[model samples]
Target chain A: METPLSRTDRTRLGRHAERAGTTRSDLDAVLDQGMVCHLGVVVNGSPRVIPTGYGRIGGTLYLHGSTGASSLAASPSQEVCVTVTHLDGVVLARSVFNHSLNYRSAIIYGVPRPVTDPDEKLAGLRAITERLAPGQWDHARLPTRKELAATTVLALPLTEASVKVRQGPPIDEDEDYALDLWAGVLPVRQVLDAPEPDPRLPPGVPVPPHIARRATPTS
Target chain B: METPLSRTDRTRLGRHAERAGTTRSDLDAVLDQGMVCHLGVVVNGSPRVIPTGYGRIGGTLYLHGSTGASSLAASPSQEVCVTVTHLDGVVLARSVFNHSLNYRSAIIYGVPRPVTDPDEKLAGLRAITERLAPGQWDHARLPTRKELAATTVLALPLTEASVKVRQGPPIDEDEDYALDLWAGVLPVRQVLDAPEPDPRLPPGVPVPPHIARRATPTS
Candidate 1:
């Protein structure tokens, strides 16, 4: 339902602008496919990028951290960037200059606001938990009132975002294509291997169906 | 030969200081394990994070982009943060508050210097190429003089960096451990699927061993 607008002055692509997607759905696809994002925030007059899990509900992306995390606590006041990327393949060309990676990525720039309302905070936490492992929120014990109070959730609007995607085989110069060389795409995949149960688990606890089904390729 | 010193004022870990590694080897391991890095820079008085490939040789890391790329060109004078992250697993705990991700990440902060010397420029380009596809750099045709001139390579010192690693099962509160719930780690792996040769490649061209070997787990 959220149609992303054209690039604004701040979020415009600087190079290879053709790869930038024109629709907001493209941004949603990239964000939904990724499990983790690199959050860039300024600290002590410099930039710090932290890798963490995030969730998107409609037009807002939610990121939560410990209340004690100075970076997240400071993020509300300063502009921040959240980037999610999926490496699809390695583009091997006949010439080194033409080599590239096939990837889909979304970078969101916004000034996040702290989610102080208890209802929104809980919903945001559910979104994040379900993003990492679907159905786990219902299967596992929910957060307690005290736990919710200790967490800090930041909501970033997707209004200012860019989605760039590149795929398929390498595009080399016409002359280079005649060369006798092995050139193609090597597909990359992120998969969840067999689940490992905790050493302290009671003898008969079974792995839930939701977790078991994830042993396949993700994207 | 590079022995990383103790945390300095710049590289000091602000949160979860216990998870930060103290040795330089830790930084090297994180760098070598990753192919893509999120580069964070300040543009128009706000943070912008871009994802790109990088390579490391000894104490320096090299990044390349089109000479016209505003973000890379603007990075030489201002402070930039290059972060490489590997998502290892999903840590599901009995309590939602205790859920975490097992990951290894390195964040390097420095002012990148433009590599103008031809020799270092070529070498840096080789490092970047080989980092993505190991033997393809040697097998493929090297960049021409014109291509080299059009590219911009920047070298960021590895002296100021922070490495954070989190692994194993979630550590829930002692009382919460008594709950009857399934909890453990779901390992994440990045793997290469079989190569898809370019449709236009000559029939006799064979898949190189360098690429065939990557079908296994990357890290």
Candidate 2:
């Protein structure tokens, strides 16, 4: 059986307790589907949030940044919070006060360890690259030694994480349902358009199947 | 002349300084376009990040949440960071090291003040509601006084904010450009699908023009 997500005092849901996700898969699903995560760390006694790309390998989450980035530099020394949120829709209710969003969010709290092992570093980088563009790792030139040295990868275990999901139509108050108002969900989704080839491309190189396949619109 | 954005010691860009956006309008544009923002606050000496909805009126940003929320409750006492990010495309380069994302992001840092004035509170709630649904405030029933008392609205100034925007195609190294690989941007966007009316809607109310107008896909 898969291990369940940890529910410590910090991860415990207070307001909408019903929306909290229980199992480990719930956390993974939210992390895997997201393209970017907002990483939070305290610097000079002030909170700083940075939006950056991330990848996950099993229970370990990998985040890469320029070694010179101040936020990344300050992250390893203290506990950090990484949040991945997907806005699914807007919930419109009969009253303005009832307006809420349909979203799935995962929050992980941990002190990340700077990845130093060269082999693991490569694996982490591969996970990050493949997460953004699948099948491109083998097709493109891999990172060189100099390039790897300039990058910093940090790994945070997914031991302390919580997932919250809200979906479907708005729930208006019992009396307010009688009101003459249009109330429903405006479903929102991220889609890919046709790929724009580089202006410098020399003649006949066609768009690869991996990239082209994703460009097809669902709607 | 339009006022430029304040550049504090913290807001100064260190890496990729060229991507920094100048002027107050640049900051406004980034904040205005986004539907959600990640709020960062230090709670009990550890950083906690929460994804929440926000709206900007002039130079002040308003964020609302349940009065019981721990993140929102802790925000007003100390400095908080709010970040809004829009992912434009996947910048696929010839080498994995050169791959990047085309995105626009704004980071705001300030000590939020809890709005206590009843008139300003209602206006702040309207701004937050209108930001998500343009015309819903007038269409829906306004918040009751009892409901207003249960919500918390925190206002943070846009005085210390920075915007970073990366657009267009990826830039590869001179030598890597000769490689036989597909490298370009896979443009991404959030779109609305057909509205799903509430099952309990009392039959004859038609979808408003404001909501219907947004459902038409641009692509």
Candidate 3:
């Protein structure tokens, strides 16, 4: 269990301040709830952050990318930052300074190693596919030799990750309570509607249960 | 108008490629919809991307901080890459290689300058405040002279900003199309529910229209 670090442990989120009240379960939940993550790294000394799809299996994160000259895939033992954030809503506070966002996010710091084991690489691919669209792995064409070779998978252990969360309404000074300000959380949520089949489908390809079960609201 | 430059456009959302169009309005819309952005810059000849709040007034972007000795803000004429992305959903394709995300994002490239003019500084701060919480600016405490002196705001003109959008369903290869693959959009939506007032409110503080508006849903 890693508690969220804060600037002063005064409740303000901080780094290296031992305020990291985060749990492995917290990171797992956030990762399971999200598919895309912002991969941050220094490229030739300039911080580059790009959002992309990622899959988590147990204690490791597998990011599938092209081996073809991607700055991310080309890195050699460089420090990387992977962030997954879920926006809960716009926290509308009474004061402008107090205005903040309610969100659940996790930032993982590590040096990813390229996956070279063919068996593990294949398993890694399935994790990513199933994570994105549940029952599609067996339904779709598996990666070919060349295509698999062209793909780059980076496996980053999920250690040293920080999960920071902020929920509820604004907490103002006691005196400001009477300032005639409206304070509350404008809750934000993500919902999935019916899945729209491909327009080019030849017909009669029914939706699978794994994918169909997702047509409702997910927390 | 600036379009985001990267393989993100040409690689992932090829099906919705043309619909991946960007314009000045799109950029502004994204700017208005977001309160925080990932600030990317070369820190000490290496890249470091940090999440920071920014307010964009038309083509000018205002960002301020009080880190005191941030390697990023301290730079005078460094080239910076700023990205504002609103995540739509995690696109879980049937194939690991095909996994993607549905998102609307903007990337701006600029040479930032330290704001010096007093009036411009005031306006920049206001822009930031208003951007974060629309109607709360007038109700909040304005930055004091001492606060202003300690904080530094950088003005990044949107002279080279670009937008990249990925929407709609996953497009698999022709052969894979025939596979009984469960494919479609797990449509990502943001919902804004009723506001929750502060527990300690003194009463008589009504919710403002800006805070009352519902979330904008786009498929």
The prediction achieving the highest TM-score against the true structure is: 2
Where does the lowest 10-residue lDDT sum fall in candidate 1 chain B? B2-11
Model 1 stretches with alpha carbons more than 4 Å out: A217-219, B217-219
Off by over 4 Å in 3: A1-19, B1-26, B41-48, B68-79, B89-96, B139-141, B146-150, B215-219
Q: Which order, best to worst by lDDT?
A: 2, 1, 3
How much lDDT does candidate 3 score? Answer: 0.69
Ranking by TM-score: 2, 1, 3
What is candidate 2's CA lDDT for residue B112? 94
- Residue B32 of model 1 has an lDDT of 93
lDDT of 2 by residue, B56-89 (tens): 8998999999898888988876999999999999
Binned by DockQ into CAPRI classes (incorrect, acceptable, medium, high), candidate 2 is high
Better-scoring candidate (DockQ), 1 or 2 = 2
Instruction: Please write out the lDDT profile of model 2 over residues A97-210, one tens digit for every residue.
Output: 899999999999999999999999999999999888888888889999999999999999999999999998999999999887899999999888898998888788899999
Question: How many clashes show up per model?
Answer: 0, 0, 24
| CAPRI quality level assigned to candidate 3 from its DockQ score | acceptable
* lDDT minimum window of 10 residues, candidate 2 chain B: B210-219
The residue-by-residue lDDT of candidate 1 on B1-219, one tens digit each, is 758745677578777788897778999999998889999998777788889999998889999999888888888878999999999999988888888899999989899999999999998999999999899888999999999989999999888888999999888899988999988999998888989999889888889999888876533
The residue-level lDDT of candidate 3 at B91 comes to 58
Q: What is the TM-score of each candidate against the true structure?
A: 0.97, 0.99, 0.83
The whole-model lDDT of each prediction reads 0.89, 0.92, 0.69
